[model samples]
Target: MVRWQVNLTVLWLGQFLVMGGMTMIVPFLPLYLQELGMKDPHEVATWAGLIFAGNFVTSFLFQPIWGGLADRYGRKVMLLRSGFGMAIVMTLMGFAGNAWQLLILRMVNGTISGYAPAAVALMSTNTPKEKMGFAMGTLQSGAVAGTILGPFIGGLLAEWIGYRYIFYITGILLFAASVLTLLLVKEKFNVKEASAKPKISVIQAFGQLRHVRQLPSLYGVTLLIQFAMLSTMPLMPLFVAELHGQTAGLAFFAGLVGSITGFSNMFASPILGKLSDRIGPERILGICLAGAAVLFIPQAFVHNVWQLFAARFGLGIFMGGLLPTVNALIRKYTPEGMESRSYSFNTSALSLGNMLGPVVGGAISGYFNIREIFILSTILLFINSLWVYKTLLVRKTSIEVNFEDERPR
Candidate 1:
């Protein structure tokens, strides 16, 4: 295979391992807290929430710093740094004596977590521009597939090998991914050229608006896409329970409902990505956003779990198109020499969305019906679609016309 294709394949695997290992322990956090001697159920719940969100909070703050460094040095070194750092932190979590230790370790894990973003930066610079959507989409599929399977595998492994051992296994997997990247992934970063370029301070990294006009808006798009999709996730089990009634198979059905979107997403992302490559990422993004917004409305009205399942499946097909297209556009608009910084800032936006979506969803569910969250997501996504069309598509058309007018004839 050619070099970019090779980079994509290896990085896809690395992303899979990173995301899967990270997510594996998420479902079992409360249980793990209990094992750590937190007997009070309320205490366990609070600790679990703190431990889980701790990672994203630090990750959101630190990603841009890492991105700046990645541009100054190289994305491959940053990838290895996150991979190895996380592996060590995850391994130590297996030995944490108390909830506080675990929480601190989790926060550290988040602080060092940039493997996926670094992978994206490396791939973005290396891949051909025309194939960028496919690269982003295919890479996203790895993470989605990992997210879908990680919880299930973690649940089973928790049952069989126990919870602490799960951490050990996760550490091993992360180490393996880093080793693979160290040996295989080829990044043609020019050391002399990168050293000669002006250093990107954290402020300079985020202060990219002066350089790239579409960047801040694109960051907003990334944040909103993540926020809209994840906002409904926390309420899913309760919603499933309400729909399915108090049945013994309720957990099974809820798991299915939670994961079915990923099934379709894993398949749809690459397909939509290729379509975007042929047509234009801007238009594909708007089409997918509108479609997802419409799908969310039906989900709010679904009377049964099966109907919700179908709605989520359809929503997945559209959701698959959103991020890859956004990444493609980010690449198209980003200044040269700042590719890593741009993608890293986008990662920070994504981390913010991941942190806030559940909190907002929970608050809305508390004040209103769980179904209202879907309506809220629908409205937000629809607004985002309109914004994309006005900012990206219309702007593209005007620029093209202006270019044609200026061309020598």
Candidate 2:
């Protein structure tokens, strides 16, 4: 097997464990908050949101720094740094004495976590261009699988061993992932290539945006895609409750309803990703964008839980294509050896959208209704489709070095 094949396999497993361990906390967050001394329901709810948001805020801030370091030192180093750092932080979070300590630790976890994107960088640099889509798609499936399974497993474990032990277990899983990466992952980083270029400062990194083709709008699409996907997340359970009018199995149904998209997405991402490699990522992105836009509209009009679930599952099929294709495009356009920074910037843009999506979803749902959130996201995605057409499809990029030629035929 080629080096990239081995690397992809290791990275895939690492991403699965990291994402699974991280998201496992979501199922028990409110309960954990209560255990941390938050008594009132309102207070617990607010703190839970705050703790979740805190992680994203810091992650958004710190990703590029780690990415830049990956370019200079090695992507594998960044992977291990993120994985082990998060393990330590997560373990500490299990022992928090108060909400403040937990909040701070969550922020720390966000600040340190970058293993997924770091893995992406490593894969992007190592994989043959002809197989880039398949690698990214397969990697995306790992993350989606983790997201799909994490909460269910966590919920079961939380019941069996309690929330605090779940945190410890999560920490252990992350540590194991880091160790796997250390033992199995390989990097072909040349130190001189990074040092040969003028040392670019963080502010200078923003200036180097010119290195990417369609910089503004590519990043814009990244932000828009993430925003559209997450816009309904914060209110999903509430929407499910309203749909069924306070049913006894509301919690189970709500969780299932929310996860259906991920379920479909988990399967669809790799398939669409491989397809994108054949037809061009731009075309794949355009198709998925239009499909998602149309699918989201049905979500607003759903009269029953099953209808809503169907709409979300359909949306997931399209949603699965968006990020992997976009990243593939980003890889195609980015300057050689700067893949880490570019992916990091993309991650930061997506993370920003994540932080804002829930806020926008909350505002729209608060003012008009949960249904309106779907409507607004539909409009945004439609506009985004037009943007994708103009920026990615119509415009001819300057840096068109075909990577397939670099690969051994």
Candidate 3:
């Protein structure tokens, strides 16, 4: 096999393992806190939210620093740093005696976690630009597949083996992925050139991106897309209960609602990615954003669990298009030698969205109801679609045309 193809193959599995490991125990955090001796229901809820949010907060603050280091040192090194660091921290979480210890450990895990962005930077830098969309799409499918399966498997294991053991298994999975990356992923790093490049701080690096047309807007689109998609996730079970009208098999049906979207997204990502390669990521992004916005309205109106399932599945098909296309566009617009930093900033935007989405969704649900959150998400996505069209598609600069010509026919 060719080198970039080989890199993609290995890193796809690496992303799978990393994402799967990270998410496998996430759904059971409240249960785990209970096991850790948090007796009060309110206390468990508060600690669970803190433990979960801690990682993203640290990750958002630290992503740019790692991105700068990835540019100077090498993306593979950064990938290994995150994989190994997360493995160690995650294993330590298994040993925590209290909620406080788990919260701190989760924060540390976030601070060290950059595997996904590092993998993207490495793939983008190594793969042929023409195939970038496909590469990114394929990589995304791996993560989505992992996300879809992780919680289900964790739930089963929680019934059989237990929670703390799942953490150990997660650690092992991360360590194995890092070892595989170390052994199989080959990076063609230009040491002297990297050394000769002048160093810049995180703020200055972002300032550099401002000079690159459409990159900043693309980052905003990344945030908006994530925010829109995830905003409804935390409320899904309650929505399912309202639709199903009972607790019987409620968990199973709710899991189905959640996993259905990811299944469609996993299947659709590569197809849309290839389409982006042909037409242009900017166009695919706009269409998908509009489609997702439209799909959200139906979700708000769904009268049954099956209807909600169908809505989420349809929404997932469009969700598949958003981020991979955004990543492709970012690569298209960024100057060489700054790709790692650029992707890192995009990842930070993603982390911010992950943090904000659930909080805003919860607040909206509290103030009004669950259905209104979907309506609000619809509005946000609609506005985001218009923003993307005005900022990116409408301009159609000569540089984008040139980039399109470079794609495989």
Question: Candidates' TM-scores?
Answer: 0.98, 0.94, 0.96
- In model 3, what lDDT does residue 287 have? 98
- Taking all chains together, the TM-score of candidate 1 against the true structure is 0.98
Candidate with best TM-score: 1
What are the per-model numbers of colliding residue pairs?
0, 0, 0
Report, for every candidate in turn, its global Cα lDDT versus the true structure: 0.89, 0.87, 0.90
Put down candidate 3 lDDT per residue, 1-409, tens digits, no spaces: 9999999899989888988888888779999999988899999999998998999999999998998999898999999999999999999989999999998999999999899999999998898978989999999999898888888888888889889999999999999999999999999889689979999999999998988768988998889888887877788888899999886899889889989989999999999999999988989999999999999998888899999988999999999998899988888888888888999899999999999989888877768677888888889888888888888888776657888999999
> Candidate 3 regions off by >4 Å?
397-409
State which candidate, 2 or 3, has the greater lDDT: 3
Better of 2 and 3 by TM-score: 3
Candidate 1 colliding pairs: none
Write model 2 residue lDDT over 135-229, tens digit each, in one string.
99889989988988898899999999999998899999999999999998888889887777777876688677765556666677789888887
List ranges where model 1 is wrong by over 4 Å: none
Rank order by TM-score, top first?
A: 1, 3, 2
